[model samples]
Target: MGTYFIVREIQKDQETGEVRDGEIHFTDSNPYAIAYAEESIANRVIDLLREGTSLNNIREMLQNRHIR
Candidate 1:
Protein backbone atom coordinates (compact mmCIF):
# COMPACT_ATOMS: atom_id res chain seq x y z
CA MET A 1 0.00 0.00 0.00
CA GLY A 2 1.04 3.59 -0.62
CA THR A 3 1.51 6.15 2.13
CA TYR A 4 -1.38 8.61 2.56
CA PHE A 5 -2.15 11.61 4.70
CA ILE A 6 -5.50 12.35 6.27
CA VAL A 7 -7.05 15.80 6.02
CA ARG A 8 -10.15 17.54 7.26
CA GLU A 9 -11.97 17.13 3.98
CA ILE A 10 -11.88 16.70 0.23
CA GLN A 11 -13.34 19.43 -1.95
CA LYS A 12 -13.84 20.11 -5.66
CA ASP A 13 -13.86 23.15 -7.93
CA GLN A 14 -17.14 24.01 -9.59
CA GLU A 15 -15.65 26.19 -12.32
CA THR A 16 -12.97 23.74 -13.47
CA GLY A 17 -14.40 20.45 -12.17
CA GLU A 18 -11.21 19.57 -10.38
CA VAL A 19 -10.66 17.99 -6.97
CA ARG A 20 -9.39 20.08 -4.06
CA ASP A 21 -8.17 19.51 -0.50
CA GLY A 22 -9.09 21.41 2.65
CA GLU A 23 -8.28 21.47 6.34
CA ILE A 24 -10.31 23.10 9.13
CA HIS A 25 -8.55 24.38 12.19
CA PHE A 26 -7.82 27.34 14.40
CA THR A 27 -4.06 27.45 14.62
CA ASP A 28 -1.53 29.96 15.90
CA SER A 29 -1.01 31.10 12.33
CA ASN A 30 -4.75 31.33 11.67
CA PRO A 31 -6.43 31.86 14.98
CA TYR A 32 -10.21 32.43 14.98
CA ALA A 33 -10.42 30.87 11.54
CA ILE A 34 -13.45 28.91 10.41
CA ALA A 35 -13.35 28.05 6.74
CA TYR A 36 -15.03 24.96 5.37
CA ALA A 37 -14.75 23.80 1.84
CA GLU A 38 -18.13 23.66 0.10
CA GLU A 39 -20.19 20.57 0.83
CA SER A 40 -21.32 20.44 -2.78
CA ILE A 41 -17.69 20.46 -3.81
CA ALA A 42 -16.95 17.70 -1.36
CA ASN A 43 -19.69 15.61 -2.92
CA ARG A 44 -18.19 16.11 -6.34
CA VAL A 45 -14.76 15.18 -5.10
CA ILE A 46 -16.13 12.03 -3.50
CA ASP A 47 -17.84 11.09 -6.73
CA LEU A 48 -14.56 11.31 -8.56
CA LEU A 49 -12.83 9.21 -5.94
CA ARG A 50 -15.53 6.59 -6.17
CA GLU A 51 -15.00 6.55 -9.92
CA GLY A 52 -11.27 5.89 -9.40
CA THR A 53 -10.05 9.23 -10.73
CA SER A 54 -6.51 10.10 -9.66
CA LEU A 55 -5.85 13.32 -7.78
CA ASN A 56 -2.93 14.11 -10.11
CA ASN A 57 -5.44 14.22 -12.98
CA ILE A 58 -7.71 16.52 -11.01
CA ARG A 59 -4.85 18.85 -10.14
CA GLU A 60 -4.14 19.28 -13.85
CA MET A 61 -7.67 20.60 -14.38
CA LEU A 62 -7.51 23.26 -11.66
CA GLN A 63 -7.64 27.01 -12.30
CA ASN A 64 -7.95 28.11 -8.69
CA ARG A 65 -5.55 27.57 -5.78
CA HIS A 66 -8.10 25.13 -4.40
CA ILE A 67 -6.30 22.08 -5.73
CA ARG A 68 -2.99 22.98 -4.12
Candidate 2:
Protein backbone atom coordinates (compact mmCIF):
# COMPACT_ATOMS: atom_id res chain seq x y z
CA MET A 1 0.00 0.00 0.00
CA GLY A 2 1.04 3.59 -0.63
CA THR A 3 1.19 6.40 1.86
CA TYR A 4 -1.11 9.36 1.57
CA PHE A 5 -0.95 12.82 3.08
CA ILE A 6 -4.34 14.40 3.49
CA VAL A 7 -5.04 18.09 3.84
CA ARG A 8 -8.40 19.49 4.82
CA GLU A 9 -9.37 23.10 5.24
CA ILE A 10 -10.46 23.57 8.79
CA GLN A 11 -14.21 23.85 8.79
CA LYS A 12 -16.75 25.19 11.21
CA ASP A 13 -18.77 22.95 13.48
CA GLN A 14 -21.07 20.87 11.35
CA GLU A 15 -23.93 20.50 13.80
CA THR A 16 -23.66 23.73 15.73
CA GLY A 17 -22.75 25.93 12.78
CA GLU A 18 -20.28 27.64 15.05
CA VAL A 19 -16.98 28.70 13.55
CA ARG A 20 -14.31 28.15 16.12
CA ASP A 21 -11.87 31.02 16.38
CA GLY A 22 -8.73 28.95 16.24
CA GLU A 23 -7.03 26.29 14.26
CA ILE A 24 -8.91 23.05 13.84
CA HIS A 25 -7.12 19.83 14.53
CA PHE A 26 -7.62 16.12 14.04
CA THR A 27 -5.22 13.45 15.15
CA ASP A 28 -3.78 10.81 12.85
CA SER A 29 -6.41 8.47 14.24
CA ASN A 30 -9.32 10.67 13.32
CA PRO A 31 -11.38 8.54 10.96
CA TYR A 32 -13.64 11.29 9.70
CA ALA A 33 -10.90 13.41 8.15
CA ILE A 34 -9.28 10.33 6.72
CA ALA A 35 -12.40 8.90 5.15
CA TYR A 36 -13.58 12.26 3.87
CA ALA A 37 -10.22 13.32 2.55
CA GLU A 38 -9.76 9.98 0.87
CA GLU A 39 -13.14 10.08 -0.83
CA SER A 40 -12.59 13.66 -1.92
CA ILE A 41 -9.19 12.79 -3.31
CA ALA A 42 -10.57 9.76 -5.16
CA ASN A 43 -13.33 11.85 -6.65
CA ARG A 44 -10.84 14.48 -7.86
CA VAL A 45 -12.86 17.12 -6.12
CA ILE A 46 -9.64 18.51 -4.63
CA ASP A 47 -6.00 18.25 -5.42
CA LEU A 48 -3.79 16.11 -3.23
CA LEU A 49 -1.97 19.25 -2.11
CA ARG A 50 -4.70 21.80 -1.91
CA GLU A 51 -4.02 25.23 -0.40
CA GLY A 52 -0.40 24.88 -1.57
CA THR A 53 0.42 22.81 1.48
CA SER A 54 3.76 21.63 0.24
CA LEU A 55 7.41 22.21 0.99
CA ASN A 56 7.78 24.93 -1.58
CA ASN A 57 4.87 27.30 -1.08
CA ILE A 58 6.41 29.08 1.93
CA ARG A 59 3.14 30.60 2.99
CA GLU A 60 2.29 30.51 6.67
CA MET A 61 -1.11 29.09 7.57
CA LEU A 62 -1.52 30.37 11.11
CA GLN A 63 0.27 32.53 13.61
CA ASN A 64 -0.41 30.63 16.79
CA ARG A 65 1.22 27.37 17.75
CA HIS A 66 -0.83 24.21 17.57
CA ILE A 67 -3.32 24.01 20.43
CA ARG A 68 -2.60 20.40 21.22
Candidate 3:
Protein backbone atom coordinates (compact mmCIF):
# COMPACT_ATOMS: atom_id res chain seq x y z
CA MET A 1 0.00 0.00 0.00
CA GLY A 2 1.27 3.46 -0.87
CA THR A 3 0.15 7.02 -0.19
CA TYR A 4 -1.22 9.38 -2.75
CA PHE A 5 -2.49 12.93 -2.88
CA ILE A 6 -5.67 14.20 -4.42
CA VAL A 7 -6.62 17.72 -5.40
CA ARG A 8 -10.17 18.85 -5.97
CA GLU A 9 -12.12 21.93 -6.78
CA ILE A 10 -14.99 23.06 -4.54
CA GLN A 11 -17.73 25.34 -5.72
CA LYS A 12 -19.68 27.75 -3.60
CA ASP A 13 -22.89 29.55 -4.44
CA GLN A 14 -22.54 33.32 -4.40
CA GLU A 15 -24.54 36.38 -5.37
CA THR A 16 -22.38 37.04 -8.39
CA GLY A 17 -21.34 33.52 -9.30
CA GLU A 18 -19.81 30.35 -8.01
CA VAL A 19 -16.62 30.62 -6.01
CA ARG A 20 -13.72 28.21 -6.05
CA ASP A 21 -12.38 27.04 -2.78
CA GLY A 22 -8.87 25.59 -2.72
CA GLU A 23 -9.23 22.22 -1.08
CA ILE A 24 -6.52 19.55 -0.91
CA HIS A 25 -7.05 15.92 -0.09
CA PHE A 26 -4.49 13.31 0.92
CA THR A 27 -5.22 9.65 0.62
CA ASP A 28 -3.70 6.25 0.69
CA SER A 29 -4.27 3.18 -1.44
CA ASN A 30 -7.61 2.73 0.24
CA PRO A 31 -10.57 3.49 -1.97
CA TYR A 32 -12.58 5.16 0.78
CA ALA A 33 -10.02 7.92 1.40
CA ILE A 34 -12.13 10.61 -0.11
CA ALA A 35 -11.15 14.07 1.10
CA TYR A 36 -9.03 12.66 3.84
CA ALA A 37 -6.90 15.83 4.05
CA GLU A 38 -9.10 18.70 3.14
CA GLU A 39 -7.52 22.11 3.54
CA SER A 40 -9.44 25.35 3.29
CA ILE A 41 -6.62 27.35 1.71
CA ALA A 42 -9.06 29.61 -0.10
CA ASN A 43 -10.88 30.37 3.12
CA ARG A 44 -7.55 31.09 4.71
CA VAL A 45 -6.77 33.50 1.91
CA ILE A 46 -10.07 35.26 2.43
CA ASP A 47 -9.29 35.61 6.11
CA LEU A 48 -5.84 36.95 5.33
CA LEU A 49 -7.28 39.42 2.85
CA ARG A 50 -9.76 40.60 5.40
CA GLU A 51 -6.86 41.06 7.78
CA GLY A 52 -4.97 43.13 5.14
CA THR A 53 -2.26 40.57 4.63
CA SER A 54 -0.70 40.37 1.22
CA LEU A 55 0.55 37.20 -0.39
CA ASN A 56 4.18 38.16 0.00
CA ASN A 57 3.62 39.08 3.64
CA ILE A 58 1.87 35.84 4.29
CA ARG A 59 4.70 33.94 2.71
CA GLU A 60 7.22 35.76 4.82
CA MET A 61 5.21 35.14 7.96
CA LEU A 62 4.91 31.50 7.16
CA GLN A 63 8.62 31.26 6.60
CA ASN A 64 9.34 33.01 9.85
CA ARG A 65 6.98 30.71 11.68
CA HIS A 66 8.72 27.67 10.21
CA ILE A 67 5.46 26.39 8.77
CA ARG A 68 7.11 24.92 5.71
Q: List the residue pairs that clash in candidate 3.
A: none
Residue 45, candidate 3: C-alpha displacement in angstroms: 3.9
The regions of model 3 sitting more than 4 angstroms off are 1-43, 66-68
| Candidate 3 lDDT (Cα, 0 to 1) | 0.46
Question: Once superposed on the true structure, which residue ranges of model 2 sit more than 4 Å away at CA?
Answer: 1-9, 13-27, 35-47, 51-68
Ranking by lDDT: 3, 1, 2
User: What clash count goes with each model?
Assistant: 0, 0, 0
Ordered by TM-score, highest first, the candidates read: 1, 3, 2
lDDT tens per residue, model 2, 22-52: 4333233444343222332323323323333
The sequence of per-residue lDDT tens digits that candidate 3 reaches over residues 7-67 is 3446777786878755434444436432222234333444554566665775665557633
lDDT for model 1, please: 0.45
The lDDT per prediction is 0.45, 0.34, 0.46
- Provide the TM-score for each candidate, comma-separated: 0.36, 0.20, 0.30
Candidate with the greatest TM-score versus the true structure: 1
lDDT pick, better of 1 and 2: 1
Instruction: State which candidate, 2 or 3, has the greater lDDT.
Output: 3
